[model samples]
Target: MLVLLLLWTGCGSAVPPELAPDLILHNAKIITVDPDFRVVEAAAIKGSRFLAVGSNDHVLNLAGSQTSLVDLEGRTAIPGLIDSHIHALHFGWHITKHVNFSTGERLTVESMVARIGEWAKNVPPGKWIYARGPYSLDFVAEGRLPNRWEVDAVTPENPFFMNMQGHVGVVNSYAMRLAGVTKRTPDPEGGKFVRDPKTGELTGIVYEFPAMNPFRGLIPRHSLEDNLNAVRKANEVFNSLGITSVVNLAMPQWEFAVLRQLWRDEGLTVRWTAMLRADARVFLNKPYSEVEAEMRALGPPTRFGNDWLKINGIKIVLDGFVEAAYMREPYLEDIFGKGWRGILLWDRESLKSALRAAGKYGIQVAIHVTGDAAVDVALEVMDEVDREYPVAGRRWSLEHAGVMPTEENLEIAERLKVIISTQQSMGWSIGKTFKKWWGPEMGGIFAPNKTWLQALGHPYLKAGSDNRPINPFIGFWAYLARKDVDGEVAKPEEALGREDTLRLYTSNAAYGIFEEKERGSIEAGKLADLVVLSEDIMSVPEDQVREIKPVMTVVGGKIVFQQGS
Candidate 1:
């Protein structure tokens, strides 16, 4: 009996200890972005999760014989950035194909025409030629709309069209002819066909819904393979920038199908949460049981689909861009002394009904509300629905929340736990234009980010790039430095501290996506998703933040990207 007891004890002791980690990273400045926002020196990864995060000695001790060790070489590491709002497939498609007109001296119509003429000469004859990201209104001091004749002079045979802000476009005569639009073609409801004042002819400029439908039908439909290729290209760009996850703001049904195909094929690299476009009428009109069953069959909303993709929420655009004067607001006078109030896509009753129905189904809604008036209306609808359906923990978000929201609206949002998914880059990009239109007082009131800070006293605010060439670093700089893209400082008093700005991109963004508990921070038991930067962002001068580049990016314990040595 004594021998047996001793043998049993020896056997238990001989059971091999748990194996150590497969990877260890040490001698690094690691910004955890955790609850305490801790900074550590070393981190150990077992397979796809952080096993230990602490001192270099502690983390190194967990490294097994075959563990790959990475010396940080004095570089700085932070949590992998997750863009809260981006049009993933669209961005990919446009970047790969479209003629980017956002930059250069060719901002004016004449310059644009000259450039298009140059482009048309090289492309195949009769091919569908497309260009995007033009800002003709910016150059037209009188806010003159571009007409088909101007574009026709450049590419008469080519069906040329370019989107100004995703909500409006100007097409050439060929494209217009293909769409069968004429001067007498009545403007579709909820859309406007810009007309020549003297001739009363269609000018090829269209706004809101009407403009979108015709071209949308004519535009070459992306094949599943083409979309997958686009996704691959997008992932390469994102991983290069250390962006591991992104919330695709709005994806069309076909694009969603492509994403699903990529996921099934295990080809997706970046984690995605897709917001189904509200215009997906067929899906929205389906029976609740049918919809639920379809969603279930596809899969639940996930952070990474256990590896790559996720479907988080639905997106709805309530109004048009602020520049187009389509945002509902305190009416402002245009250059011609015409008072133009903004246009709402859906009537108040329709919006309210949709919100109520969405809330009932437990689907979080992300509504695009740019102007204060629009914000107020959205809040009112959300509040009404919350009173009835009462989503307890779901994080509904207000996209763009650019203008100053009312104190009452802020309070309600705080109480109901709605997130302000703002594009801080706007303060730099378009805030100057607002100042010109409304003057100092009203313009200052327009992007009253400070007002929200004071009213709600640190509400859940997430920073979004809006895919305007404003990455996390640019956003950080804008928020902390209070500087415009041109290096001019905005209202200094509205500027947030560096730490606060970081939180806006990291912790707050994660919270907005209902992913706060998993990947926002660097900690044990959490996914080892992080980025290493060439410079220490926290300690760098505010003006230099944009200069910093990602040196390395890790997702799910694997190094996905590394800057060329």
Candidate 2:
């Protein structure tokens, strides 16, 4: 009867059930993270939102006989963390795609070929042998990439392809032939088909995502059931980490559709907002004009979906990764040997036109940049587009701004009210590569979270794991402790405080997707998404931040995960 009342009264009309909370959590420290950052003793959840937040006595009094009561036993609770930027579908796809590598396994060509042989023998014919990671020849025992003849002997009956950190890739002759790779084939713009240095022959090595496009296109698509289960496993991992929300940039757009279906089935515990990647590379056959028309034709506009699933907008990756980031100055060394500043994905005027077309349609534009020069290009285009669309408070984002931050760029982003979605895990994953690859001055610019915090408040700066190592604590340790995988401090000067980091992961992340008013904090009338921690992240020593874990995670007033369960 009471559930019927809530259903009839709805979330509006201020249901008089304020005296009867559906769930009461007491005997715990509740970090409200409200305007005052108040720490309360208890919080009451009625339906999908917090009914009240106050002392234990105050909240327990509101609970009725039907209410679910849980004694937290003095655990610490905080707002559920949100990953501001993520490749959601990509994470799920690896599972369904039959990825062959395990976590932290050093890859080798012989191991890879053997794995392919095993799959061919055991898993039946016609399945593509696939694996991807930082699996370059650097790890192969021979210290060199296996050429076509070597791979063909094993993979002649099966197609085999493995990407190295999504940067470089090695494909077997069978896969190459199937994908129509010929010696006469011209390299795609901003991508390379690496040839043997001495022989001037095609070496079966591909550089950049654009170059791998044709080969990647050859892989057969997985089934809907396979994809659905993959996403379920992904969400379960996220729930265990206390992640209740994410801003997913589903590159292929198919992942976005599957997530919505999962949500409809009541299987998704994490609230997700999607940004369809606006990569012109995908439509290789279509002209730019047609692509622009499609951009303008994108339906329902930005922020069109509801709280659970929404269309955030489109993401335009203007440049490449660390070494390929378009820098203002030439690289200290010609790493790519392309006169090395960086590779620009799209040309200027044409990209500007694309931005205008999307902006004119009221589609929120999220531009990705990692270099100073790339930042300039993004800002100029956005500024011009903002004049027409008004970007202030529009939450137009600049993803991956940490690689090459400048005070000038920071000020411009601040003035335009652009959100900077950053990942410090780059520092962790890249490990000690910064100093060697980009020089000391460039390395210092890796991820200046403190500098970013000064330029843009906690609310304007968002934190995410990028894709790998989705544990928020692992990312937090990188930011707070400033250590790389080698246990060496990458840069001590750029470390962030726990409070600022927490806000970036929660309240600040909420604002990025326009969900700040609905969630991000533990105040009354806000969504009851929260985490019970084994140890207080704020109170723990800097080195121990990564040791903290979520005891339980709750989303939309229900416990989605518990450590023991």
Candidate 3:
């Protein structure tokens, strides 16, 4: 059936043989996430952009003999997904540089200890055995993090530092001794060196950068070549998931340096814009004046590079989530007693100075603020900055606000015209944690994606997976099913429909990185980036959505990944 459906023209007009499309994909459902959400039958690509998006006959006729043709065999295709927030460099290092203890199964305390035990024998005593896990300790079989003593059993001499996520970790006694962390050592501001409550002894458990940096600083930095390779490996994984573009929320100078080198060498696979971190550690104890001077010196301004790679903003992770999300009210289960709300990483004045500096350089600021109280503080700072110099249309974002911030704060964000960059994908994974820490009342508001969408409007609310498993489908399933780890629907009233969820990861996500005009939707003149799915995502059972893998991934008219290739 050669359906002559022309997306734009309505009438299929033939072009001259000399002006034919370079490539055509026909006999497939092309879900063009345009204003009308048209479902076209085919698409034509010329150079690195779309020439036409229509029916099989409309596009197939436009392909010349020299043009390439891919018969999709009735598969469903959508625009290549754009991840609004990712830590690709860190993810890369997690996979390549560090010793990974995950193997498609849950890690028990026994297996994790044994894995490190084997790896320690290869290296010298002083060497740091930096091991990474798949996701957090929540994913482990023992249902808790392996103790420091268990790690010490593996490596008595070496300083063993094993982390689930970067923030939460366990370190051996040797590592503790080497870092000068003792039972008497005081807790760092905004981070914790967790100790036994009854025993008053160091448990060797660490939380946040402040507490972890001591041991982290001991590890040697990866070389430029190592980082470049890590980025390549990370890109491969992203491409496999049909992700063509990403906005890295927290990228270090060295990682950005590696990416820049990749861009210069034409070695990049995924499109990304890095948000350089405003390191709290670097400016710690320094006054606003000194910090402002340093920030003012950050050159090249924002949006410095080209399409594939650019420095678009500065990221400030304001507070920790789960245990320490800066909250208005006290936590349901106060890990730290005394009716504690979460702690802010930076003081009020320092935060204001950082924002002021970023504004001076016309840099976009995306603060990682999860709790409502943190959002309040961030908005107050932004409002102050706006009073100084209007940031009305600057695209400053509140990363992870969709998860915890109240509807009122979201409304404030809307009024301020601030973007809400969130990880809809993390809902299912972190839902139980929310329940345990924040209780049922607070946990019910896990991912109010609908509320966020209604408040911020569609384009202003962007989506991404902040952590592994980095599959966007996990988020998609969570959004569609509204299910948590226990299969309980979290915040059913705030749940989203299929199309709306797709918009978040596609058109909406593209807008987050300020690249919507180029490649978010399937349209003529847009970059030819798309993914052919293994099944019809629109018709697939919500439970099976996570299994819908990408058959082929195309970026800028180039096929970057193909299954069974």
lDDT of each: 0.71, 0.76, 0.80
Top model by TM-score, which number? 3
Backbone collision tally, model 1: 0
Model 2 stretches with alpha carbons more than 4 Å out: 1-19, 100-121, 135-156, 182-186, 198-203, 281-292
Q: Highest lDDT among the candidates is held by which one?
A: 3
| Alpha-carbon lDDT of model 3 | 0.80
Q: Where does candidate 1 have its weakest 10-residue lDDT segment? A: 8-17
For residues 290-368, what per-residue lDDT tens digits would candidate 2 score against the true structure?
7568786654478888878888788888887755778777776776675688877877766777776776677777778
Candidate 1 regions off by >4 Å?
1-18, 103-111, 135-147, 184-187, 196-202, 280-307, 324-330, 334-338, 437-439, 444-446, 454-459
TM-score of 1: 0.87
What CA root-mean-square deviation does each model show from the true structure? 5.3, 4.5, 3.3
Candidate 1 lDDT, tens digit per residue, 1-565? 2233234334543212245667788999999988888999998887788877888865665555678899998788988888888877766776676676643122556667777789898777666677765433443433454578988887867887777657677788888888888888887865778888998998887776565588767878666677788788888788888788888887765677788887788756577778777653433455555545544443234332444666666788877665444344444555322566566665566676666666656667888887667788888888887788884467888888766566788788878777777777656655555566555554422345566655644437777777654366776776776554345665677777777777777777777776777787888888888899999998987779877899899988988899994
**lDDT score at residue 206, model 1, on the 0-100 scale:** 77
